[model samples]
Target: MINTYPLLRPLLFSMDPEAAHDFSFAQLDRLERCGLLSRFIDKPLIKPVHVCGIAFRNPVGLAAGLDKDGKHIDALATLGFGFLEIGTVTPKAQSGNPKPRMFRLPEANALINRMGFNNDGVDACVERVRRSRFYQEGGVIGLNIGKNASTTLEDANQDYVMCMKAVYPVASYITANISSPNTKNLRDLQGETLLRQLLSALHQARIALSDQYGVRKPLFLKIAPDLQANDFKFIADLLLEFEIDAVIATNTTISRVDVATLPHGNEAGGLSGSPVLNSSNQAIHHLFQSLQNRVPIIGVGGIQSGNDVRQKIDAGASLVQLYTGLIYKGPQLIRDCVRVFN
Candidate 1:
C-alpha cells in the first residue's frame, strides 16, 4: 500500500502539537474499530529477535509515552510493532504540566515536550491493559513506571515499588523511568546514591512479585542523555551489580545544542527526534563499552530511518524503539526499520 501519512501530515501539522496527537489517535481508534486501518498501513516485517528472554517478532517496537495509558494497544498493535511499551505511569493520576507544553520543530524534525508523566495512573493503566485484546493475545508489552509529582525524593522508592507491583503481572517487562526532564528533579534519581537506593528497592520488589506471579519479569532502566561522560560507566556498573535485565539508553534529552536556533528551541523539557540521534548513539556506545554485552541495550531517541536503526544496532543495541520518529515519519518508519533487520 502506498503511504498516506505524507498526505495526512499537512493536516495534522496544522493543529496544535498536543491536539494533533490526540486527534490522530482518536482517528486511529475509529479506523481500527471500523476495520479500515489495515487498508492504509502495511503489516510489519517479520525479523524475530530474542532479547532479555522475550521473543520479539521484530526489533522495531513502539517506545513508551505514545500510549502512556495502554488504551491504544490494540489499534497500535495492528500497525505491526514487534512489541508495545506503555506508560511512565505513577501511583496516582495527574494532569501533568500546563497546556501548550508540546511543540514541533519541523525544520529539525524534533519535538520538545514537558508533558510530565500525565496519565490515568498505574491502576487504571493496568485495568486498560487487562481489557485490551493485545494483552490477552499474549503480545509483548513493557510497562514503564515512575513516581508521582507530589512524591518526595526520599519517598520515591515507595512509589516505584507500588507501580512495579501493580504492573508486574501484566508486564512482559517493567521499566523504571527516571529520566523525563519534565518532572521536577526527576533526574536526581540518576545520581549514584539515589540510583543505588532506588534500584535496590526495585530489585527486592521484583523478587517478591516474581514469586507471587510465578513469572520473573525483566526490569529495564530508562535514563537521560545529559549525563557526564563518566556517568555511563557508573550506571553500567550499577546495572551489573543489581542484575537489571536491560537498559534503555538515553531518553529525551535536556540539551538544546542542535535545535537551539529553531522554533521552540528553547522550550524546557526533553528534546527528541533527529536532533537527539547523535547523543543517544553516543550514550548507547558508552553503555555498550561499559556493559560489554552483559546487559542488553534498547536504543531510542531520534531514530528516523532504517539507517538510523542500523546505527543503533551497530553501536551495540540489541533492540531499538521509536517515539518522536513516529511523529515525523509515521508508521512506514516501523516497516522501514524492520526491513533492515531482515
Candidate 2:
C-alpha cells in the first residue's frame, strides 16, 4: 500500500481537492460493489472508542470534511475507520461558497478549505444514514450539523434546532458545528449571547427529540481552534450551562498566524494539519483543565501518526479524529494508530 500510495496520491493530487475526494469515494464505491474492500483493505482497522455515551469501534475516525453528506459512509467504513462523522450538514442543502475553494499546502502537510457547508442537507444525510448499513445497524456514526450560511445569528437557533430535530434519530451522537471560518458570520454565533442561546435551543430540541425517539444520544459542540483563553472560557461555560454531553476541541483554524514559514501560509481559509497541532492540543488541554474532566473531548487537527494519536489521548481526549493526516499518511496510519490505542 505504501508503494502504491505514492503512485495513487499524485494522480489524485493533480485534481482539485474536492474533485479528488469525489473520485476517491467513487473508487471506494466501485470497490465495495466489487466486494474487494474488506478482502484487501479491512485487516483489523477498528479497536474500540467508548466516549460520550457512544461505543465507537476505534479511536481513529474520519473527520467531518471527507464525507460531508454521508454519501460514502459504508464505503469509507470498509477502509477501517473506527468511526465516521458525516456532514457539516445544514438544515437545507446548500452549494456552499464558490470554488477554487479547497487548497492544499503540501509542505505543511495541511489543507485549507473554504468549502463552507456544502452538503445534501441534514434531512438528506439522515435519509442516507437511515438506509446506511453502518449507522443504522448500530455501527458508530456521528452527524455534525451546522447552520445554513444565509441564516442570521439571531435565527441560527432555528437552523440548528431544525438540524438536531431531523438527524437525531439516526446519530449515535449529534455534533453542532459552529466553528468553520468559511461561513460568513457563522463563527459570530459562537460569541457569548449567541452561543448560549443556540445551545439552549439545541438542548431543548435534543430533549424533546430524545423523548420522541426513546433513546439518549449525546449532543456535542465542535469549537474553533483559533480562540483566546477568554473565548474558551466563555464557550466552556456555555457547555456547562447547556449540559452539553461532550466537546469536540476543534474544527479548524483560520489563524495562518502559526505557520508563517510554510508555503501558502497566507491562504484564506481554516488551516488543519501539522501547523495547528499544538493549537488544537492546547485547546484540548484547556478544555480538560477548565472542565475539570467534566466533559469528554474528541481531539482533531494535525493528527498524522500513532504518536500524535497517543498525545491526544494523553492530553485528555477520549477520541481523536483526522482528515489531513489521512491525506498525508495514507490508510496504514489508521491501523497503526489503532495498534497504539491497544
Candidate 3:
C-alpha cells in the first residue's frame, strides 16, 4: 500500500480547511466508485473486540463530525475502519454557524471546528445509511444524533426521540451527542436533570423500537472533555442508572491551553488533536473508575499514533476513535492503530 501522505499533504493544506475536507471526501468517493481505492489499500487486519454488545472487526473507528450526514460511509469504509460513526444529525436541518467555521492549527497538529451539527436532517442521513454498502454488509455503523439548533432546550428530547426512532432500524448503535461546543446551550443537556430526562425518554423509546424491529441496538452518549470530576461521576452514575450502552469520552474541548500561542489557537470553537490527548485520557480514566466496567468507553481526542490509541486503551477505553489524527497523518493512522493490537 502507498502510505505516503507527505506527497499529498501540501496540496490539501493549501486549500481552505472546509474546502479540503469536502474535496478529500469527494475524491475518496470517486476513487471508491471507480474501484481504484482498493488497489492501494487492503482491508484492515482483524482484531476483534466487543463493545456495547456489537462485534467490531477492530478497536479503531472513524469518529463523528467528519461524515456528519452519513454521506461518505462507503468511501470512508475503503480506508479500513473497524466502524464508522456518522451524523449529529438533527430532526430538522438547519444551516450551522456562519462561514469560516473550521480552522486548522497545523503548528499544534490540531483543529478547531464549531460546525454546529449542520446536517441534512435525520431522515436524509437515515436514507444515506440505508443505501450504503457498509450498512448492507452488516458492518458496524453508529448513527450519532443531536437536537436541532433551533429547537428550544425545553423540547430537545423530542428531537432526540424522533431521530432515535428513525435510525433505530438501520443503526448498529446510536449516539446521543450533547457535547459539541458550537451549538448554543447544547451542552446544557449534559446537566443531571436534563440528561436524566433525555436518557429516560430515549431508553423507553429504544425498548419500544427493539420490540418493534425485533432487533436491539446499543445507545451511546458523546460528552465533552471539559468537566469537573464530580460532574463526570454524576454522569457515569446516570449512564448506569439509565442503562445507556456506552460513552464516547469526549467530543472536543473548548480549552486551548496547549495551543493558545499557535495561529488560530484562539479560534472560537472546540479544540481537538494532540492538545486534547491528556484531557481525553483523564476523562476516560475517570469514567472507567466511576462506571466500574458496567459501561464501555469509546475514547477519542488527540489520537495520532498507535501509542496514543494504546494510552486510551490503558486508561479504560474498550475502543478508540480518530478524526484529527486522520487529518494530520492520513489513512495510514488507521492501520497504525490496528497494528497496535497485532
- Ten contiguous residues minimizing lDDT sum, candidate 1: 37-46
- TM-scores for all candidates? 0.99, 0.96, 0.98
lDDT of 2 at 139: 84
| Lowest summed lDDT window (length 10), candidate 2 | 1-10
For candidate 2, what's the RMSD? 1.6
Candidate 3 residue-wise lDDT, 1-342, digit = tens? 667687888999999999999999898999899999877777777899887779999989999999999889998888989999998899988889998999999998999998888898999999999999989988999999999888899999999999999998889999999999998999999999999999999999998998999988899999999988889999998999888999999889999889888888899999999999999999999999998899999999999999998999899998999999999999989999998874
In model 1, pairs of residues that clash are none
Q: Which of 2 and 3 is ahead in lDDT?
A: 3
Q: Assess each prediction's global lDDT (C-alpha) against the native.
A: 0.93, 0.84, 0.92
Candidate 2: stretches off by over 4 Å: 1-3, 258-263
Model 1: residues >4 Å from true position, as ranges? Answer: none
Candidate 2 lDDT, 1-342, residue by residue in tens: 432565689898899888988888898788887888777574655576677777788887888888888888888888788888888899888998888788888888889888989988888888898887886677888899888878888788898888888887788888999899998988887788888888988888878887888897899899988778778787888888888999997888988866667766787788999888888999998888888888888899898888888888888888888889888877777887787786
- What 10-residue stretch in candidate 3 is worst by lDDT? 37-46
